[model samples]
Target: MNEYELKVFDEIEDWKRKITRRSGMMNRVSKKAQEKINEFIPEKVHELMTESIKGMVKATLFGSQLTTNRKQAIGLSLEERDELVRIKISSFQKTAIIEGAGTGAGGILLGLADFPLLLTIKMKFLFEAAAIYGFDTKEYEERLFLLHVFQLAFSSDEIRRNTLAVIENWEQRKKELVEMDWRKFQQEYRDYIDFVKMLQLVPGIGAFVGAYANNNLLKTLGETAMNAYRLRILQKAQ
Candidate 1:
């Protein structure tokens, strides 16, 4: 499983930790927002809200491993925040494009449920930053392909329940293992791969359509592809 799959269950908890973990930065962002409060909202509570906005934005931009997240977050101004959000939306739109180009059944299965959730969260920030951005029906076709794939692959009720159970287990364990031991994590990772292979067979579909049934699978492919690209670029620099 990739980090996102590992993170799926405890997404909110991890986010809470990330926000508090950088308290000084949070304070600074809050401080700035407080300064702008009189002009923006005139309410004292709204002024205090600057920190929450700042912390949330900071986390959204830096928290996710997606390159688009990091890229759009930099050098932002209040004026530019809206545009940044647009870029973030477009970035995911491009992901929809790639998913359509061919991630096969496995890719499609993963995309349906997963993409919408991911897009929903990403857009929540993007939309709030600027009111104009919202979910597009035009993008539905490709995203639907993903949903179809997931539904087909994990068609059985029992398998879905078991998969979810493991996900919950991973989430519960992760908080306790925040400063995880690499060697142990590595072993667990190997086991994860083994488990995925076993589950993949259960779907009994073609490569193109198979694993797409589960939302988790597409995330793995997307992350792995991006990581490989980054690794190659770094290798060339060396």
Candidate 2:
């Protein structure tokens, strides 16, 4: 491996360890609290939420593909691709921040709208990242991989560990997997972001909270996406 590739390999190793690490006391307590709250919610409510998120995500996936540049980067080294992806991440982050501030300023109605808007921004960035990495997002398995990457960024510690394993072995694992578990996907994602996002609905501080939360969220997603594609590329070299 070149020096840049080796440096990235080490970074990926550190990221792998960090992601699969055990959760702290606060995380455990928070997860349990969320679970208790979830139990009190009606089953129908859960079903409705799952279906809503599923539809929203499916629509975003379709729309992102329509808008994403179809041309895959070719004849580029890992460093070159990484440079392009960093630029894309910065652009998307700015977009997310603006959208968050706008929706958040509009109160509850617009705060609610931030969910889908932010989701679309994240997915579009993932598609761009995939293309930069020379992966064709139009391919079914590639899109599915992006979903796993999304889950990895937002899930609880246990789910994150399991999802990382799937991503790590995706070349072989994709053959065995038919489709994602939409219920689990939606629940985990919602649970992960619920607290901070809820703060975005508060009338007084909603706009500030929304912009700050979205900026950090997009940053997390960008780091996760980069390391994920790095893992795949470096592993293939091995």
Candidate 3:
């Protein structure tokens, strides 16, 4: 590997180590508390949450209609493509911040609206990222790759490791892979953002919390997408 690629590989190792590390005591406690809360809730409430998450997951997985909308940057080097992606990520981050601010300002009602809206923004950004990286989103497998990238961005450590393994060996694993578990996807995603997103529902400081949280979340996704594609690209070069 060249110097830059070597550097990226090292960074990927660091990221993996960080993400796969055991959760701290506080995090474990928080997770346990949430689990307990869920247990206490009526089955009907659980059913409603399942339905809601299912709807979000369906909207995400079943429809990637934006594939054609992401203009491809043909004839670019990986470095050039990623520079353009940086620009795209910046633009999308601004859009997310605006959406978060607007929703947060509307208090409880619009805070609720933020879920689906943010999901749409994140998916669109991923589609555009894939296209910029010279991956065709029109293909089903490539779209499935995007879902794995999303999961890697938002899943728990154990789930993230499993997702990363699939990503790292997607060519081989995809032969055996079917659809992802929608319930697991929804649970991990909700759990990953539960605390900060809860703050976005607060009446007084919701706007600020929403904007900050959305900005950070997009940053995380952008980094994950960039590195995931980098691994693929570099692996192919080898």
CA shift at 177, candidate 3, in angstroms? Answer: 1.4
lDDT by residue for model 1 over 22-94, one digit each (tens)?
2356434543453454356445554355444434433443333233222333454323443444454455545
Please provide, for model 3 over 1-238, each residue's C-alpha lDDT reduced to its tens digit, 9 standing for 90 to 100.
8777787788878877777788788777777776777678798776777778777755764565544455678888777887888897898899999999999889889998999989988988888888888788777788778889999999766788899999999889888867766667777788778888889888889999999999999999998998898889888888
- Superposition TM-score, candidate 2 onto the true structure: 0.96
Tens-digit per-residue lDDT, 78-141, candidate 2: 9999999999999999999999888888899998888899999999999999989988887899
Off by over 4 Å in 2: none
Best candidate according to TM-score: 2
Candidate lDDT (C-alpha), each: 0.34, 0.91, 0.83
Clash count in backbone of candidate 1: 17
Question: In model 3, what lDDT does residue 69 have?
Answer: 53
C-alpha root-mean-square deviation, each candidate = 23.4, 1.2, 2.2
- As for TM-score, the candidate ahead, 2 or 3, is 2
Q: What overall lDDT, based on C-alpha atoms, would model 2 receive against the true structure?
A: 0.91
Q: How far off is residue 129 in model 1, in Å?
A: 18
Model 3: lDDT equals: 0.83
Rate residue 11 of model 1 by lDDT: 44
